[model samples]
Target: MESSSALALSQLPYYIYPTIPNTNKNYPFWPAGKRRSSQLPTRLHCNKMFVPGFGEASPEAKAAKNLHNFFTYIAVKIVAAQLESYNPEAYEELMEFVGRHPLNDGDKFCATMFRESSRHKNLALRIMEVRSSYCQNDFEWDNLKSLAFKMVTESNTRLMRDYISETSRAETEK
Candidate 1:
């Protein structure tokens, strides 16, 4: 049998050296007689392990999580509205995929089937209706409104100017 002590330490670069017995605290791998003024060169594994963006600590991951949460809430509302029962098996399959996959994957999956036929179009509209209900109730459409305001203010086009005037008049009347 090969003894562990016979193995060279350098071969296992990732081995935590501090765990070894009788290794004094002066340095991780310092020889007992070493008395140099300079410290031993420390090996720092600074490279972080690659984490997938779908569920990692990144901002994109956070946004994807938020989107998935919102999608789940919308789906629950759709199910409550009896729309889910109309196509029980399809709804279950979609929910299963949504639960397991990332938001971008879900979007790609939906887009691929969203316009395949009239039935798909109708289903897409129903999903949109569910999302609209959530947006209306949660007051979560502010970003879109802000974007529209930005476009209206920045554009010097005649149509935009007309829209600005019409909105301003409507606001005054209200």
Candidate 2:
């Protein structure tokens, strides 16, 4: 007697995404030797977890939660696929850890920013605005610099053309 939406949702893969392992702490909730465990209640609380929106939330809330989780999984999968074209190793690692794992929205944003160079600083900065919460300290600084270099040096994007020209002029003056 479930609604069509409910049926659709049931057909989609559902899993409690695991958080990436941190250097400092151990996650005790995922019982040893288990491939999947129920999602923990609060990301901060390792001990407390239950089926999301099962008993405590209203039907509307449950729908919303399901939608959010579904979309997050899709988005991460898309980004990981994009990484595969540019950096296969990074793509593999991201997929292995983040594809089915739980991460805050900020962490997802950071994952996309792992690119070697982007033509869009404004976009990158916009994503970075959320960086305060979930950046894992995993990005390579060299890649970031290379990204900036491409943005400025490439003919396509004009974000730093004037600045680069001015700097070159000053260097020549010296």
Candidate 3:
């Protein structure tokens, strides 16, 4: 008298049936005999992750880094300006060298500057080294170099006149 669909439905697994709500006082979801452990496992050590040399530096270290970066920047500007004004061919050669080497950071810039045996490059490197014993800051070497290059190359004589007057005034004051 049972239909085929009814038989098939009855043959399905027990878990397929929806859970019935338990209304008994002694038993909750679990059966009467079984009980889960109440206490959780204790952690033996801290869960915090650490990385070496990735933490903040001391105030003195930070100041030294800033000073180094400042001097490097000034040296780069001075070199570019001098080359642009005094020797156009040497300035072109320097730009070509920079393009080839792609100085991305301070250390790379210093190394490349020294590697090339040019008077301007040597002077610049000497200036930077005398200012700072180490080069750690990953300053924008390419952009700064190009900016200084363009500033001196594109500027009119008026700026130079103003700079001369300012220097003379400072000399008088001193």
Q: Point to the candidate with the largest lDDT.
A: 3
Please give, for residues 1-174, the per-residue lDDT of candidate 2 as tens digits: 222223333233346443523322355674555433342222232333334545778565875565444445455555556667987875666555555545555445455545524533333343344332223344355786798678767755564777789899999999
Per-residue accuracy of model 3 over 26-75 as CA lDDT, tens digit each: 45665544444432222224333333453587555765566566666665
Error of 1 at 118 (Å): 1.1
Report residue 7 deviation for candidate 2 (angstroms).
32
Query: CA shift at 172, candidate 2, in angstroms?
Result: 99
**Model 1: pairs clashing at backbone N, Cα or C within 3 Å:** none
Clashing pairs in 3: none
* Per-model TM-score versus the true fold: 0.30, 0.27, 0.35
> For model 1, how does the per-residue alpha-carbon lDDT over 1-174 read when each residue is reduced to its tens digit?
122233345334555444334454856677766644443333434344344444536665676566755664564456435646687765765556446544444345446446555655555556666655665686456785798678887775878789999999999999
Task: Give candidate 1 regions above 4 Å deviation.
Answer: 1-61, 68-73, 76-81, 84-106, 138-174
- CA-RMSD of model 1: 19.3
Scanning candidate 1 in windows of ten residues, the lowest lDDT window is 1-10
